[model samples]
Target: MMTDAGEQLEVQLDDCPPGRETFNDPLQEDASGPDSHLSSALRELEEPLLLLADVALAPPCGRAVFYSCPEAERVERSLQSVQLQLHFLLSKADDLHDCLLGGQGHVEREALAAAISSLLYTCQPYFNHLESTARSTMAQYTHVPADMCSTLLDFSQQLCDKLEQLVLTYASYGLLSLNEAEPDSASHFCVGQTQLGQLKLTIFRYCQPTPYLSRANTQLYKRMRWNVERVRDQQQTEEEDGDDEEETFTDYYFLCYEDIPNPHAEANEDSEGVSDGSVVRMWSIGQWVQANPDPSTEDIWDWILCEVPQGGYNRLLFLGHDEPSSRSATDYLQQLLLSCCTD
Candidate 1:
């Protein structure tokens, strides 16, 4: 996806200097001493710093570890950023609790709760994605060095635990949803934890590489997980005799127009309207359906991928394939178009 020049730029960007650490806050320093109880408590509360050395440099387990890669290191840095942000907000939460309990007005307390909720909401998706990627990466490891796989799982488990605590704390303070029906708890957290556990279980069940995919075998189990529509289709097909569906088409039309600026325009707004290059692709799908109410099965694929071009726009279709399972049908559609283009 990247050109040689682009790759060189990426390498240069990666070589940029690391910024100074801001872990120490002079204002938060205790007057007593480093050994003071307050200072010690604050130090203990510092967030977890994900270190690549801690994860990858340890004794080798029988199974391979995913953290040996540079990409994994970048992931670790991102995780550390999230952890640090969580800790920062947690300290604020503690302050707000103290302020509210000290008879602060409802408005201020409500605002603090809102702040906490916003921060936690922002974190949910990032951590969820991170955990998902980690699970998928671990699945690729065949003979996971016993030391590597278990240690990596342990790191993932720790991250999950930290996120869970933060979510529960925010919920307790009325800043987050504790609803079982909500995606945060029921969908995201549950699925993430389950996936992480499955990763560990894969390594556990299969001391060595095995063909079978269980919660234990990363590749087999993870890949086999079907999407909702596919599952539903399977269920329906099983109930019936898996009869093929017929296709139909009908005609549809829309008014065509060239770029014409609207009469009403604000001073700051551009009055030129859409560019002349802009084109609208129109097709009579309804007419096509009416023309062939029961078209041949073989024609469907072609019909879908067929391109319909108009003045300025074009429409192309793509078919989904099951493979290493990286990109979706939509992602491949762009590539398909590029492939058809003149060099």
Candidate 2:
């Protein structure tokens, strides 16, 4: 739970710099049991929790800040503390959910439920951003041991579990009332509007190392669940019987310099018939309609936004090595923004 702070967490960190902060422990000496356990976890967290909070609460600025390598001991300690905290938090949340005095509807009406929902809703982008930046931001930049990989994976699952539990507990309950009309209650959602000629783009870096989401099928497995390797085996199982052929694989453009051989050179030509050595492709509502010959394409777009799963989308693959320290998606992102402004 991020409290409304007097100053931004970023400013506090710059001035106090984590370990240097003079933090007075708020735990009363008389406390025992669960309270004592929580206090101990918090005490161990000290500064690393603040760093996590800062990242969680910060606005999505479309830039990945890979932390400079830290002492291995510090990294392990920080990760361990987070694991401990998450375990306690999940246990307590489950306990509270079970002990609620009234029915689910009654619990949903409580301000506590609404507040928790709001906080989690606000953090929707944070986890998505984390999934995108997990590889380079932590392991590659932190320079930690290979042994930490399992620990890190366990932490990731625990974090995801906490999120799943909370969502199941309060997502629709706190946000939507059974009595209220869909249009009225749905107004609380993070909705966007677009007019004719409108174009909105958000940039994100790919940081998932394991599967790396290289293709539509690989990305599809990730959305199905994180155990992608297993998904490959169980994909055609009777339980998951569905029309696999309907699943679309995005056509991708291999982006590289003029010196590099164009993968699609045989068909290379721009709308204006000018090749500036830049591979090009596009996706839009209009283009989507044109690409798919389905008669219900427009209607499909309207209802499918909520049902649309992550994956099966075309992703840009750069030819060169993506150096964590020297160059990453952030640098290319800067140029994209500059070009947008230039146009």
In model 1, the runs with Cα more than 4 Å from the true position are: 1-103, 141-343
lDDT by residue (tens digit), candidate 2, 1-343:
2222212322332233222114222111111112232222133333553344233322235654344445434555556555554454455445435534354556434544434333322222332332223332333343333344344434444544454455445545553332212322211221111111122222211111212232233312111111000123234543466544323222121112113334665555679985665443321110111122343455766445533232233333332422331123323433433354469
Please give the TM-score that candidate 2 achieves against the real structure. 0.32
Model 2 residue runs over 4 Å out of place are 1-73, 99-112, 119-133, 169-343
Find the candidate with the highest TM-score and give its number: 2
lDDT of 1 at 74: 56
TM-score of model 1 (CA atoms): 0.29
TM-score of every model versus the real structure: 0.29, 0.32
